[model samples]
Target: MLWLAFHFRALSLEVFSRGAAAPAPLVVVEKQGSRTWVIACNDAAEACGVHVGMAASAAQALADGLVVRRRDPSAERESLAGLAVWAGRFTPSVSLAPPDGLLLEISTCLSLHRGLGKLLKQARSGVTEMGYAATMACAPSSHGAWLLAKAEIEKAIREPARLGSLLAALPVALLDQPPAVVEGLERVGARTLGECLRLPRAGVARRFGQALIDELDRALGRVPETRAFFEPPASFERALELPAPVQAAEALLFAARRLLPELEGFLSLRQAGVQELELACRHERRDPTIVKLGFVKPTRDAGRMQLLLRETLGRTRLPAPVHTIVLRAPLVLPLSASSGDLFQARNGEADGDLLLERLRIRLGKDAVHGIESAADHRPERAWRPCQEQNHAAAAANRHRPLWLLPQPLPCHDGRLQLKSGPERIESGWWDGGDVARDYYVAEDRNGAQLWVYCDRVSGEWFVHGVFA
Candidate 1:
């Protein structure tokens, strides 16, 4: 089995710094007994002479505007699991390596992704888009791939015969063995895997115990290794915490843009589209401010989603500065796959409705309405307002006027001359409001076309609509 491993080297710092989401000079610290030490630092912090293992006080003394944050194990794990779901878009067999690593069995599915080169390119680009730094490596064994990733040796050692030689040069400290075992190997002049392998197998196993030999065997693929695959949730809901409170609703899109692509990946794997979404912004003392978005039709396009969100946020007013934002898509519907023609042309009408959708968000859902024909033949009751876009064609037999007045205006035949013959419309007898009239298209003296109908019951003529 070929395993591809991704080791997020700066996950601890990224969990808080959040790249452009919070691009401040930051350092993540941890407490060892009494003294706190820096565990991770971003590039901005590094430029200020802030390095890992330095005392937190020393780090602050060196950097003038550095932001100090403590390491959060829970957030790291959540971030890793979220990435695993994103990785599901590329392959199905994904295994979690806690404390920042992911193992993907891509040997069986490389062809599906257009071979290894394109798959790796997409995976690396995706990690960057999610605002994290990661190192990736592939090998014949899971342990070997993981070790190579951790060591920052970015290469794919596909053959089992080459894995041993490449793993031999790696230090013993990169192994999963206990500190005591690593120290024991170092003290005995076995600093590298190659040096340790040169020692007598019986003596080495007896000295460091069988676990060390087993680890080595697993890395070399001499023994079988079992892994439990990661399973993503049915729905999508991810939260992002900003380092600083943001007052402007539009400015929050910088961080929010990261989650959208991930959401697109999730929906793509499920072959579904989301119709409604909820963007909840959290404040200090007040409840979360929810800004809901609706679509005319189901869609999983991230670009379209982002566009609608930007328009909605522009009109939204924030009650307080938001510290956290959560994106939720609860309603998912099946979206069938559609292939473009050879020229890659898309339907123009669907694109035209995007403007309507944007206007609907900016104004209000109730403000905008589509119209469709009704069953009644009366000019006033011929059509009705619809809440959503209806593809059904308007049912019509004879010519009808679009600009119908609310009540027919009384007019004299002397001022108007009839141009077309009478077209009778006499339907709607079951209800109380039944009508029997002979409608005619007429031209006014000033050349304005009018739709006049002769009332059969009243023996009078009235103008209902203008054809202009």
Candidate 2:
């Protein structure tokens, strides 16, 4: 089996920088005893001579305008787990490697992505799109891949025979052993893995304990590796807290874009489409403002959804500064297959549906509605307004006018010429409003077609609608 490992070098710093409005030196510091030390630093901080493990005060003294934030381990863990869930799009077998890494078993899925190169490219692109920097490596053994990724050695080793020699030259620190064991190896002139392996196995195991030997064996593919794979959630709902409050709704789009690909991946894995989505913006001291988006049909296209969301945000007014944003998809359905015609430029039904959705977004939901058949027999009560066209109901076997007048008008005596006709309708007696009419298709003085019906009880002729 082939294993792929991804190591997020500065996960905390990356997560912090994503919410920043401008590029500046930043470091994530953790309280160590009475002193604060840098656990992660961004590229700007590193360029300014601020490195990890340095005192926060010393780093601030070295660089001007340095931003130091307290390290949030919970947020880092959540981000890593979310990435692992998103990795399910590539393969079903994915496992988290604690604080800053992910392991994926991709041997079965390599062929589906055409080859290892394409698969690696797609994986790297996806990680970059999510606003994280990752170093990736692949090897036959899971531990071997993990070690390579942690060492920043980006190479693929498929041959089992090549694994031992490839990993031998790496530093002894790459092994999953305690710091004391690594120091002991370094003191014994075994700074490299090759040197450590050359020592007597019995003495090394006795000195460093058997766990270190087992880890080395696993790395060399001599021992079987076992790990629990991550399972994706049934529904998609993710939230991100901004580094600073955003006062405008338009500014929230940049932060929201970070989550769109994850949603696309979730939909792709399930082979489903979303019909509706909700974006909840959490304020500091007020109730969350919810922006709901409804689609004319189920869709999984991320670009289309983002465009519609852009239009929606343009017209939205923020009640308060947004500190956090949550994305939720409450309704998802199985995607249906559609085939296009060769003669037409585009599908008329699809274009119409998209247009209707755009109009609904620009105007309002209540302003746009379609017509559908009703159960009543009265000409005025035969149809009702609906948010969506009921195609099934429209297929009923009945003849009706294209345009119905709001109120019936009396027909002139000599202006009518009957064409076809005498369809009798008698109903609506339950509500004390009974209708007895004989409807017919007729022509007036001109060549215009009209739908005129006669009241049988009163013998009064009325023009109800026009065909055109």
User: Which candidate's lDDT is highest?
Assistant: 1
Give the poorly placed runs of model 2, Cα more than 4 Å off.
Answer: 20-24, 44-53, 61-65, 111-115, 198-200, 233-235, 267-273, 297-300, 331-354, 387-393, 396-422, 429-468
Which 10-residue window in model 1 sums to the lowest lDDT? 336-345
What is the clash count of model 2?
A: 0
Candidate 2 residue lDDT tens string, 45-105: 8999999999999999999989888988998987887787678778889999988999999
Q: What is the lDDT of residue 422 in candidate 1?
A: 92
**Which lDDT tens digits does candidate 1 get at residues 1-468?**
889999998888787766245477889999999999999998889999999999999999999988899999999998898888888877778999998999999988889889999989989988887888899999999999999999999998899889999999999999998999999999999999999999999999999999999999999999999999988888899998887788785668777777886787677778777888888989999999898888766677777788888988888889999988898997877776662111112666556557778888867787898888777777788788896643666555445677889899898656888888699988788888899999999988899988899999998999998885
TM-score of 1: 0.86
- Deviation (Å) of 146 in candidate 2: 1.6
lDDT (CA) per prediction: 0.85, 0.84
Q: Count the clashes in each prediction.
A: 0, 0
Candidate 2 lDDT for residue 253: 81
